[model samples]
Target: MKLNKAFTLIFLSFYSFSKLLAQTDETYLFPINPGNKNYLAGTMGELRSSHFHAGIDIKTGGQEGLPVYATKRGYISRIKVSTSGYGNALYMLHPDGNTSVYAHLREFSDEIAKYVRAAQYENKTYEIELFPDPYEFAFQRGDVIAKSGNTGGSTGPHLHFEIRDEQQRVLNPLHYGFDEIKDNIAPIAQRLAVRPININSRVENRFDRKDYYLSRYGVNYAINDTITAFGKIGIELLGHDKLDGAANQNGISTIEVFVNDEKYHSQIIDVMSFSLMRDIIVHYPYDIKVNKGRTYHNLYVDNGNRLNFYESKANNGYLNIEADSTYHIEIKMYDPYGNISTVTLNIKGKAPAKQIKERIDFELDRISYQVEKNILKVFTRENCEEDANKELSIYINDSIKTVLPAYFLNNVAVYLWDLHEGIPTSVLSCNKGVNISINARAIPHQATVINAENFIVNFPQSALYDTIYVSTAYEVRTQDSLEVFSIEPVTVPLKSSFYVSASPQFSHYQKDKTHVYQTDDAGNFSFVGGSWSGETIQFNHRSMGEFTLVTDDTPPVIRPATEKNYYYISDNLSGIASYTASLNGEWIMMRYEPKLRLVWIEWPEGMQNKRGNFELKVKDNAGNETIYTTKL
Candidate 1:
């Protein structure tokens, strides 16, 4: 029996070593040239507006037509072409059950281009996605597959590269031999924060969290003094990583929390699914909503978040702070290259302040409205226990229409009103206008609708994921070029697209150029395409914000950035829609950077003469066109 046990120990050790060896042995050539002076504009697992950036953005010297090579011996398995999102992308599947993706390409190789063009013409559309057989377009290692460019959602000229497992989960390419990209700098912690996790809890004697700005001390970061907290509390760190010689601050690859020298929680961003991208909100939702420029990583896991990146064997990173105890806390942040930065602090738990129970008056902060079938569901945060069996007033267009009894749900008030009788002009609660209407038959589920003098909104049942009280209003801006219909308080989130129809006064010639646009809080407009049906312009949009009608008839302006090299092009009203360039009457590739309003062509190899007549043409979304010709 001792001999058997000895054998089992040896076998286990050998198996563990073998697994580590296999992981290190799995090799991949650099997708882009490692020797090139390329820097990553975006890192894997970087936090974005609505999702985590799934890939790395490899800079191409701010130019296009750089040869993109395959990382391994693989066959082109999928090809997609579109005006947005990875404009022209290719997916190559290798024998090791991993796929490499190259996106935003200027053009494919000769053979693949021929096949894709033929398929595009046959299908009669510029956007196409095809799954080719494994045997087709097989490429050996280091074969040039395509040329990188600024296409799709790219803001500049760069290649968005990705590596994925067979299950289609996006894996950080830096994990697969690309660690050769040097990064000696460590993550920098800007601030340390602690928050109360429960309603009864307090941080620094308040319900809100407290932040401590870090001061550099001896190669690491530390708070000036320890913090006093009580009850359940969570920790958060505002930090970012900097690559050597790169100006951009990127996301850290890993974060681990240690409590009294014991590993309490960890977040590893090695792989994640696109479906779980929304979980980013719950990770550090308050920070994302309040702070626009900084990223805050939450050390504790929220109850609703299902992101697989977090691992905590005990308490989900929350500390139950009890009196007469001191907890030493340490946090380690790591970059993909294993450079580590640490921050240490101490938390002294104290007994919470004594509570004095008193009679709480019922007050409503906000009212929410939703429709289910023919019943209008009204909800609000009121002290149902104190205001039990009270009557709530429902008003339509400033007139008291009915009084309904409030029902209690988990200490909150709920009221149901039947709308099968007819749609009201406007529903009111507490004498405030809560826009509510039903243009169609019974709503399938809960929804909100807004009807105004010149506009009507239909938010479908699936449009909202939570009960929302939308505040809307309209105003005409005579100072602007056209009439504007504004929707106030645009911060509300929507799950699906909602429909809006508006009647705007326009001239006969202005009709063709007029379309609905979404305006920001600062009154800047982004064109949201709409079509006219008789006198009303209707459109479907996925955001809740101010809408307006604008007519753009100005042509794009084209000027040479450099007399011999690049051109600057821009449109003041609607943005550039299409552009073409020709050298000596031969069509040349012109890479467009919409954000910078610049378009330029890389001089092809062996084209020596700089003297030539160049012609450039640009068109805006409003069909206004501009042509410029100059001698180089």
Candidate 2:
């Protein structure tokens, strides 16, 4: 039996590779319509908040229930259903050692749907993941597999599709033979930015970087003038792509930078691994933090970025210009269809300008902290030109903890503390009330606990990626009837989710209506559900920010958008969680678009003109439910 199993595995691997070669020779059909027009809403390697988008988003004409077909002969390998992220997703493992994913689906085909429903009932949960045997389900190319819909984290109706190799690396779907889809439009360059990378460097006689709006000139964009710079400098481009008929702006496919007509850096978005997705932030970290709705590509690669998309970087794409000279810079942007756009600029290298150091005033609001390795690095905007050689005191629990000498890097004052020494208790404060309370074990590899008057925080050894000093505090807003707990600062990124248990002052009657919420920098609260245990509420969060206990008693409101049947649904406090609509006693399919706050059901075929009693039920995250009944 063991010998037979090994022989079977070898045969399957060989068969899969053979199928892969055949498909590469243009034997497979498009996953959707083969002859109809198809547009892409997003592309592989698109930069997202913390990760790169690993697949393509195919437009579904802003509607749901579009038939999704199998791209090749494959077996149903995996199926996942969830309320968030890729709801109702299906994965197919082809004989070619590749897997095709269909996400945000409305429903599967009849046979697959039956299987899924039975599994859901057996598991007794709406969210589920299942892996079926290879012989359980199989399909040929062009077989209808599922129907696309707007589900999960989707902002609109589109099909999120992916093609992955046997090792699970996502490959650009466009690389496959989808020759019928047409895109002749080129990417557009909007702006260019130049930054002084070194402390001795200056851009246009200023220490800070400058952004220049680019205007179209013939086939290329130009800054229209030369930029004066000294020492090492880096560049950034703001650009996006557009398909022939789609109005949605998509990510560019490739970028190449040249200096003096020589290739300095290039990035081709054809493949990506799941582990390298987080490096999207490092590629354009500043832009990712500040820009919303725009795509910014950094011409330079950071020293720590490990993404494989970048290639042939000369000094990581930074131009070192110490002497008087002139250098020509050119950038080429491309779309998946081979359409290209070019931009050109000139950098005039000159002598460094006179340096006049100014003293920086340390403000309480400007102080922040970062954790790198085992060092707790404190950053302040205040220039410490004179204080660089001076020692500053760090207080823990209102007592003098230790004194560390300040250091200056690029005009900013920074202080570093080694966590291997010891972990402080209660509060960590420097001068001017810049303090935060932290649990000792909050840093990874360390064990610590924190107990305050109203909250208790427990940190596991794996909760952090590095050693960090954490600060927390509690506040009561009597006027707003809120109990706020300042967890950790937002600048610190958490590697693993942490637990927080807080005892907020609330009445027993508010138990069902009360839940924990995370607040943004603007003081706006978003629901973060918690479990109530006696008087304490416990929750786990992946981000550091302010949290509060909020009571939401109002039920969700459902308003009819169309006089015939459509309804506009909304919630005043906690967002909508679950909704259902039924005719008589049978449940009917209701298409919900949370972004548009619209919900409606298609008139059932053969019963389009039938009139009956309709009941709609909507529930919020806080357990508030509202029901509406009316004659259709």
Candidate achieving the largest lDDT? 2
TM-score of predicted structure 1: 0.67
Off by more than 4 A, model 2: 1-26, 196-201, 230-233, 286-288, 291-294, 303-306, 312-326, 349-481, 487-513, 521-523, 531-538, 553-571, 576-620, 623-632
Cα lDDT tens digits, model 2, 1-632, are 45688678767856765765567443556767677878888887777777778778998888999999998887889999765789889999886778999999988998888787667545544567999866477888899999998887888888999999988999988877687577888888889988776545677755556789997975589887988898888898988888777877778879999888999999998888887776675577343354354447888886456788788756887889766798889999987778999999999997754432544344435466644333555655554456544444565544665544344544555565555555443223334335434445355666557786689877677565544556678887777767788766454445557788898766643888888889866768799899999988999887767898778999999888855789989998789998887787666656666667877774444556767889989999999999988898
Against the reference, the lDDT scores of all candidates come to 0.73, 0.75
lDDT of 1 by residue, 490-564 (tens): 444455688888877655537778777787657787978888888999998866667888788888998888555
CA lDDT for candidate 2: 0.75
Q: In model 1, what lDDT does residue 471 have?
A: 43
